[model samples]
Target: MASSATTGNPMPPSLSMPPSQFARLQPHAYLRAHLSPPSSDQPSVRANGRATSQFRVTSVNTGSLTHANGSAVVRIGDTTAVCGVRAELLHTSDISSWGVSQAPSKQNPTNTNEAKDSKSEDEDDQGQIQDLNLLVPNLSLSTGCAPGLTPGAPPSALAQSLSHQILSLLHTTNLVRADDLRIWYQPPNFDSEEFHNPGEGMEVDTEQSGGPEREIKAFWVLYIDIMILSMAGNAFDAAWASVLAALRDTKLPNAWWDDDNETILCSDDFAEAHRLTLRGLPIASSFCCFEGDAAAGWRANVIPDAEEQKKKKGSQQKWILADPDGYEEGLTQERACVVVDKENGKTIIVKMEKHGGWNVDSDDLRKLVDVSSQRWDDLKQALEQC
Candidate 1:
């Protein structure tokens, strides 16, 4: 007979150990050890050995997808996001009647009398409205990209929240002009139809009407779909960068009304397509704030000489990490996301969002702003080169 430990009913090593011992050896415990700081004297260094303020190497490529009207792939450190734009035509009659009217153009010079007449006509045509939902953006965060996501599951709350943020930034910052999507009715003979019936039917022949102005018949709706191929950190920054690149590469096909087919016809000539009017580039940067422990005098990684000053401290010290990775993000409790636009060499804050349990000092917030401005210049140059 053999001993029980070596018999056919032998158990695995984990099952042979006590429950308490097995619990302590869980994977969570091991991960925490690597992520958290061991002590105040020795701060935890980033896995990639990057400084607190330094960003990971970034790269961008455009026109990667042949099917898409415009496509781009952006990689920031380990995080990667791919964006594609699909342009579709929408007739004005199909849209809701409660849309906002388009603003008059200031590029063309008009006399006082003409301006007043145009304003009067615009007021009379109050039924016409412009669709604000032309640009639809969606983000898909799949399980293959990250560890936490489950396969075949619906979009998580985090993914939905990020999509909203990107859409809000696009609208609030005026990065893309709304007028660029409008498709006006360009008649073959403008002299003949200068003013016969200005605003009569949906398919009015402007050439026969003898009107000096062309009417808007249809417009382009851009669907921006973003996919995260990998998740390292800073998903927002990577997504926004991809959006900028895709929009820059977008070209709208030339469309005209077809009298025989009773539908709009698009020209096959790629060179005749027009480009979107991008007013300015708005770049976003994220920061994670690490709070120090009062009892242990444990300081964040960003603070300099924090260990030396442990002997002379009252309140807890906080450190700010720019472009934090997944490991750092998991340990941090506070975060700030800032979007800035550079206009004529001046930095303008497009939007700012801060959330956490800890209280942030005014001085620290100001420092974050200054850092974001500098990062914007770097990003702008990178985008221009791409």
Candidate 2:
């Protein structure tokens, strides 16, 4: 949420507070807008105090994808993503030198199956498999975030950025094990007539055994597609929470498949299929920064309003707000998102949302990490059900 004044008062120092308290406020001076007003769920004191540091409500539902090996739907505050992981059979005719398999013979039925399995697998694994990986992410802001759209409209920048971030995060973190994504290497990467090690090295034609043998390999690809059901700010954190939570509850079942080419030749009802194994869960946190006061957030445009509006020239600002709310987010300078993997014991500052916001110091980053670690238990318990 927006980082600014830790008070319930909406007025800024320039408008009401004395100059002496101004400097003391530092960044907090500009975050009044992020402070929630008194409400039934939150008492006035709790509304703008420690509770602000706390996250919005979060919920996770698993087994969302009937076809996917493992799937989850997570909703945190305003962010949500539906993550599904599917494992298919892969066949590889050209076995790596380090592969454990011994040379196959015509009498080997398993070898024969491998050859045919990979051949039967689909070649368009790239595109078809990718779509299966689409999962909702923390930053996903649905088209509904925009108050106006006459249908047949373009996606908002926020939505685009969210997709890129989610995919990049999963890719970089190796959340989906590429090796586990075994495609049945049926036809293999070649044909019988194709020459191998032609002249220079005097190659070998392994497929000459009437037909090439296929090898099956395991691969795990994660699809993270999130639809924004609401825009409660903190999309990054919300997405991260749901992803980790749902993954914990995910299961892979026994299913039929050809290991070669790593393609799903057919589908097996989940009841009888083996589920994907989840190693651990990773979470992300976001901080918002701004230049002017928090009150100016909506006016200047830092966060997405219930009604989306263009940001003011304030995209570039002098100061930074930490974890801004919708109001403070609009006025705040920029945002920083950090993801932490508890199982792997790693923390990554994903990207600096340098939208004219102030730069964060190492000390501030350390503080956020500490916060994420300490709160791990609570978040962990909340997601364990998923």
Candidate 3:
């Protein structure tokens, strides 16, 4: 084939873009614009024809940041999140003391905290174990991402909830088990080390309090931050990727106990680290609700725009976009995110976000789970590099 350009790059036949397509070209939203659903009259084709049960091109990059302990960015066909982990020193111990449900005598009866602190241990709290899991997700929308709009300086409400959900999930699930954190919950004594900051090495107590400072004890505090550079279908996958990478890159200062004349018995240094056991490398997948003729039948793989945005009782909105684009998301019928675990071959329903539900039968659910197992493998391969 004759080369269009001297290099691998193809020469542009036409430089102009249509108004509707060009209007949606924010930096982050560009992916959305490209993946937007096809017109009702035209058949839709995603990048490489990824069916509803399939995923698009995915890749993982690591060590993207140096100052942090561990860091990686996972790109699931353009939805990307960069995660960095920094270990600080903290006095952490686990002691379970039963608490009496006592309200501050003057506290408002409707205080939400009272309900939150109280434990129910339900699916909503899935993955959370009594541990110190701190996750911060930074989402900055950029007009620089899309073409015409002025990007907001701060995260929108949707972005805030994402950070809160990830942080809560990381702790509740025991993803980073607290027991593994080394210290048990206890009162800080002069002998115990304080939490280290981002720049500092592991916390170690020097013998400055009294006589010859004999003991050197340290606590490793971890700060995990994930930044969402773009938004597409799968946010959870990117979040998990960031978490895994950050831990792998993390490094702690060396610690040793020394006495007069005795050779060093043991030491923990930057080389040694605690990586998540990774008991199971399960992943989440989603399917946008689609409804074609049950009698006439459409391909189960493709989603169409039913446009079922927030229907009240008795509303007859029937159509929606499967794997909805950003604009069609609000109008989606039903969105189900399923998580599949390699261990024990178990698949759990993580969440459901949609109005009208479809294809809830066991066969469909089981098929989705089966598909997830195969689909999640690529993510696992990417995480392995960390």
Candidate 4:
């Protein structure tokens, strides 16, 4: 071979790898290198250039769908989700388990205890909603939202799991009020003075008044559909945000039971529509614990005694990242979700879910709640703008 050194081709620029390629090939090591700096002077930062406890900015838009009773679009960083709520009337006659006894009949009893009995029957409003299956929520990922999500296939495990979580939160929080869904019918002259004061020189016939003066004839079933337009990461938070915004924007028409037709009817006046009265604005925040690679240069100490090992365990280098992106999610295994509601300037934890790793402890949970509270304020402000 000819002597190329003499020709001065000059070592063709020492080949270098890009940071993006390095992150893809060695995600764990790449993250560890950033979090565990070579010197104490260097600040620890994530590969995405976000602080460990910082979350992405959230933006929301509501009432985007005219056909849907309520609709909202939420974007958290690069991830985006659209939620739509449709209400359908479910007549009591259609429910096989519904019976006449469940409905309170008009009575002429002249005691306060009798009125208490009638009120007690309707106390379990949430129970009625659950028993009748009034709320239905479904989540689906778009085909191109992420890699490996193909079209025309059955729902993936992630989708199913997310849907289940959403449904569980909805039920646990009791966000929807049953009074907003219930449709009642009052017979003619039922609210007359005779009913208000039965013994005030007035006679009432139970047969003439038909059955119950006021009875629930139907309930509104809210079908909440959430679609992931783009899934960068932290799907649960984005999905929940969309759901909350959509429900806030949802309006149901004035509905009543028709006596002659014996069916639920909706009013045509737009002014008669009313928005849903949700219990509280609950917000969801997600985080992941990124444990440094075992073989990384940060952990070069020799194995110690049992007591020393126990002491060193607490000093392990791990980073708890808030609102991790897709790349960070793949590098981490430990994750947690905190759902919180703010009441009177106090943060109330509605639900807390932690799994996939044991690095998170009680103290860590408290920190997570603090971060969630801040995130809640940010998201709440965003929703309010819509």
Global lDDT of each candidate: 0.73, 0.50, 0.49, 0.84
* Rank ordering of all candidates by lDDT, starting from the highest: 4, 1, 2, 3
Clashing pairs in 1: 193-207, 193-209, 193-210, 193-211, 194-210, 194-211, 195-210, 195-211, 196-209
TM-score for predicted model 4 compared with the true structure? 0.85
Residues 1-386, candidate 1: write the lDDT tens digits.
87767776766565376534643555334333333567867665544566567788889899999999899999999999999999988887786652344433422223434554534433332222113477789998968788978788989887898899888787766666555776666435534423345565345464345444445677678899999899888899999999999999998888887757767889999999888878688889999876555323234355667645654665645557889888667767778988888889998888888887444567777888888999998888887787
TM-score of every prediction relative to native? 0.73, 0.55, 0.55, 0.85
Per-residue lDDT tens digits for candidate 3, residues 1-386, read: 66866567877779887655654553223333334565766544433354445566767888899887678887776677788877654422222321222122311223335553313323322322332233344543333433333554555665576676666545534344332333222123344344334355455534332222222122355677777677665565566666666665555454332335322223345466545443345455656554333321233334343323212233432332223344444324465655555646555444323234554545666666666667667667767754
Candidate number of the best TM-score: 4
Query: Can you tell me which runs of candidate 4 are displaced by over 4 Å?
Result: 1-10, 13-15, 38-42, 100-123, 189-211, 294-315
Residue-level error in angstroms, candidate 2, position 48: 5.2
Better of 1 and 3 by lDDT: 1
Instruction: For residues 49-112, write the lDDT of model 4, one tens digit per residue.
Output: 8888988888899999999999999999999999999999898888886774374532222343
Ten residues in sequence with the least summed lDDT for candidate 3: 98-107
